[model samples]
Target chain A: MADVAYLPGLPRMLPALLPADDNSSPWRFPQYFADHFSEVMGWLWAHTWLSVVPVIAGLIIALPIGWLASRHKWAYPPMMTVSGLLYTIPSIALFVLVPPLLGLDPLSPLQVPIALTVYSVALLVRVVADGLGSVSEETLQAATAIGYTPVGRFFTVELPIAVPVITAGLRVAVVANVSIVAVAGTIGMVNLGLLFDQGFKLSTDTPYYPPIVLGLLLCVLLALVLDLLVILLGRMLTPWRKAVRS
Target chain B: MIGNVLRWLNDPDNWNGTQFTTGIWAQLQTHLLYSVIAVLAALVIGLPLGLAIGHTGRATSLISGLNAVRALPTVGVLVLLVVIIAPHFHGRTSKGYIIPTLIVLILLAVPPILSNTYAGVQNVDPAVRDAAYGMGMTGPQVLWRVELPNSLPLIFSGLRSATLQVIATATIAAYVTLGGLGRFIYDGLAQQDYPQMISGGVLVAALALIADLVLALVQRYTVSRGLTKRFSKSTVGGAVAADLEEAGVEHT
Candidate 1:
């Protein structure tokens, strides 16, 4: 890590070593930073796109299912159990499972998103179920008493009350996905995991090399950013948690 | 059409017979061994560290550093660190690989173990601790006689998930050329063997299921044998009843 005897960049060190993906013209960095930035950005970009769809799709699937499961004891157990089982399947295995049945090639980029989404299903589902379960019983009874229909109760009363829990779950899902999606490189898209593979490969190629250090820095930075986002997401959604903590 | 050694030996096939198992059965034996070793390794390392991390106030100071370690991408970090570490001890040999696998698995297992242990210890009913302490018990005795027993169920609960996780993840060992059931999953694909791939996937899942069942049974045993919160509550109640009557402060 201390291999670089000198440090110089635009004014100061911000670790802005990666550029956003663009087309039409080659988006390039200074020769020194280019290799480092490209690898970092490659991973960051692939992971972000791979994660976004699953997260959004999961939220859509999770919230309603959680709401329905919350309504009755009969529903909760099976839904939770199945999702739990799905979640427990190792991600790699899950990725492997899809190809034979779905007719999708194992090597396809689709494996990354599909496997991640399957994992997210369980997290989001549990979050939704737990959040709605946590809504005060009295509020539920009052909603019923006030002649609110089941659907009305869900949207107006249940959902509003449960948003914080769902939010918490989504925060967890996003962070977990970020940590997890690094594995996508095993199937071979140049992500953060790929950078590590590259850096490791580079070790015998060049001693005290630049790209390897840059990759490690980017990975740590990526983790920090994702972690901060989860925290910020929690704070944004549930201000009451702040008050409670205080 | 293998595994007819008895028939071959007795009557039909050959004078001397020892049958080789089919691919799936061979893989099953391998899977079971790997899962058991991986889970056992996790529990052995995870439990004590979990206990220390939970019980000691000074250890709480280390959570952030520990969490960062825990948060590291398990495969990537291990792959990177292992390369630097492996020159002296390569991944294939027992001396080189076992320690690293244990290290990675321990890192993976500790977060859940520590979280549960800390949560469990925090949730131990205070009155039970007080009663044990009041009985002229030493601090260590109180922890063992009261807190440890009280937290056993929670610890086991965490272990359930952690053990399953370790079993599932032990597949990553295959990537480092430290082969396990994951070999069927990864190496099978590289070789284009679908049955090997499917068999490996199923074995991992089955191993996970069995691990969970065993842990669940252990949880049941702990709960039934009176090592959990319910038993602690009742015992604490008895002590309280004795103390109150001794003080002559009864008659509600």
Candidate 2:
């Protein structure tokens, strides 16, 4: 809920603050879409990157922590408590808090992704730990009995079985990231959220339909595409599941 | 910094106002009012739908479709709805903001409640369900007496998550010129008042934690003792993890 004061180092990209009457219409669907197609695409691309990079980064960071929590009985409660607490912090608060904690400029684009990555880490750590825990003990014993080293067994045996659950976690994280990234736009990051901000300010006197509708459509489309990509990737990685199914 | 925030909070001027109608208490009330109404709205809509879906084994695709709504950005949705709906209430600006804010809050709260309730009922042991039916309980009776009780833990978990989410998000309502504890953070940010902003953040977090703790206790006392022992080993984190898995299933 922090104020939206303009900062010097940030780009002078106040789309919402543009004079509302400059365009002189409440709706400009055809003309606006035609003129901003490439620009919209660019925002979509940035939005995709902003949402996905955090999930990837978070996964990398969470893997070891998740493994630790799953492997050690004593670690599970403490690990879950810490990560759960981390998840409860409000997104807006976290966005503002991160600047001071990380020594970044308040309006830096990096803050959005960093805060999202923290969220993804918090959400995924428990998922990863739970997914790993879901692997059957007998399967693990079989791997161990086959003279596989602990590391080898984990890589070859445990992780493979854990893929389905981990993929589910990834799906949730990716979708959540998509939503959180839009919040960044509210904070002045250059993404599809700019359209929302513009639409909001533009409609100060009269409702502006095009930008708001377009922003919602594009945001949903991007989310669906990313979600489908994760599902497809999951399917590709787990061919045995299909074999078992058919 | 903490002392400064504490001092600011304790300031007589900050606390002084008309009796029972101003200061931090009023903002807390507004925040709680928004969150409670939204959660209740979500419950009214989601609980029945989830129960129906779980009981009948139909309309599951509806749940999956609704799950996608979770990915819709809350802020964007709020702004979009405001722009679309605000003009209708041309004379009353505050009502315009409040209506869209409540709509968005309800939208955000519905999914977890819907999904968890459905999953909880569906996941109930089938043998128990069959036994209840054999004992001459009607469908509604079984759902009310048997399934609902069993699903209490998950339903409570969903409500807890939904309440926390709504409370956190109600802060954004302040961005649209509505009043809540978020006023402090936003106003402080504008004035570059770090202590006030940080204090707002702390207060909101404290509220969320307290709300969660209270719900956990409610979950403890409301469910039967046997059910508690059955799930005693499962912590809040575990319940949340399970809920996330249900969410994934609903999406898929």
Candidate 3:
């Protein structure tokens, strides 16, 4: 059972590595985590990068596009339509399609992050546009009256006001990306998703519960943490909202 | 790559097998079957619960919890369910795989439908409800006639979004050895057949686009024209906001 090959370059983390004297049920999570520390951390590290870098990249890419959409009212509909169409494509399909489109290798790990970045951009463009659009015309006029340049005013006044809205979009994108990274395991990309694949592959006779449970726990936990971080960032960026509420 | 995809799609051999279920047509049917069943099941369960929460305004806090459910990884939940439940079938024919796949898809679908319905109902103009009450409409009658009708645009948007998500996930059902367009991608990947894999991506994407288009048309016809026009004006922002709320993006 241990001899079945894994995806190339994937470390063979297995239940069989446990102590020989153990005869307990497959629910031995503490023991499993203790034994496979490096492997678990490795999965977590890869999962974090794949899930996060995309959101940051997407934000940077989307800001200008989203700003353009907000500025030119006519650009809003067509841009939203295109992004909506992009969003409808399944994550799994995008994972497979990305490599060929970019001339990357079939098994390249880069595909997962690139695919996720596409999703992030698709999701964020609307959020950024709407966030910026939410800025009151009066506020813009005030900023201009203060002699702030267009670019300066955008960064200092418009962007700060848009924080709550954009961050709301960021929270969703980050959380969604966490889950999507797991789907990459199906295509042999390494991440926490590999745990699900490993668990499935190992469960020939009876169900292997440890890795599956671990993967789910880690994923939900990661999503929750990342979500809270976005909320915190949003709060920090908009202390005036908090001040007004209080 | 385009030639490879064209040739692979054009190949007669790729379209047939010893049994009808082995063909692309059968696989497409299977994919739709799984998606429809899951969506219908979720609607039956979620619609009423959401409606109850919306109508009475009790237990509305539960909506946030439901929205958070969106963050659960689809692939993780699918694999976890299959592993936990498959053993109960004692290695019986693919019931093990199918049941779990359906469950995951159902779970994937419920949140948007439920949250959207709740938001839709909750967002109904209070004046309309007061007018209905003044006309001697009972509580249930108000919900059924006034609230439900008013909320159709949002409900339909929720349904469309849910349907699109369900279709995409149904493709992943192929990963667990179920039949769908995903089979082409997964099978092609395993065998290192890039054209077959890419074509599978094209087919799944095309199907999602068509499904979304059909739903949009249905929404256009079914929703009142006045509401549709009003929604179209702000839908670029409104729909995304509704979707974001349904996703539980705003805790405050």
lDDT of each: 0.64, 0.81, 0.86
- Model 2 CA deviation exceeding 4 Å by range: A1-30, A37-39, A103-107, B1-12, B15-22, B230-252
Q: What is the C-alpha lDDT profile of model 2 across B41-150, one tens digit per residue?
A: 99999899999999999989988898877877887889877775665564545887898899999988999999999999998889989999999999999999999999
Instruction: Using DockQ as the measure, name the better of candidate 1 and candidate 3.
Output: 3
lDDT of 2 by residue, A207-234 (tens): 6767776787778888889889999998
lDDT of 3 by residue, A1-246 (tens): 364454221232244434334433355656667777899899999999888999999999999999999999799999999999999888888887888789887668788889999999999999999999999989999999989999999999999999999999999999999999998887888888888898889887666767777888889999999999899989988999988998
True contacts kept of each: 0.20, 0.48, 0.80
Clashes of each: 1, 0, 0
Worst 10 residues of 3 chain A by lDDT: A7-16
Q: Put the candidates in TM-score order, highest first.
A: 3, 2, 1
Show pairs that collide, candidate 2: none
lDDT of 1 by residue, B1-252 (tens): 012212222432122212732344454555566556655666676666666666665577555566566445666655655544444443446544455665776667766766676667767778877888788999777766677778877887777777766776677666655656676676666776555565556566666776677777778776534332133335876576667656875532
Q: What is the Cα-based lDDT of residue A214 in candidate 1?
A: 45
Q: Ranking by lDDT, best first?
A: 3, 2, 1
Candidate that scores best on lDDT: 3
Ranking by DockQ: 3, 2, 1
Best by DockQ: 3
Model 1 off-target regions past 4 Å? A1-33, A142-149, A200-217, A238-246, B1-45, B89-98, B134-138, B225-252
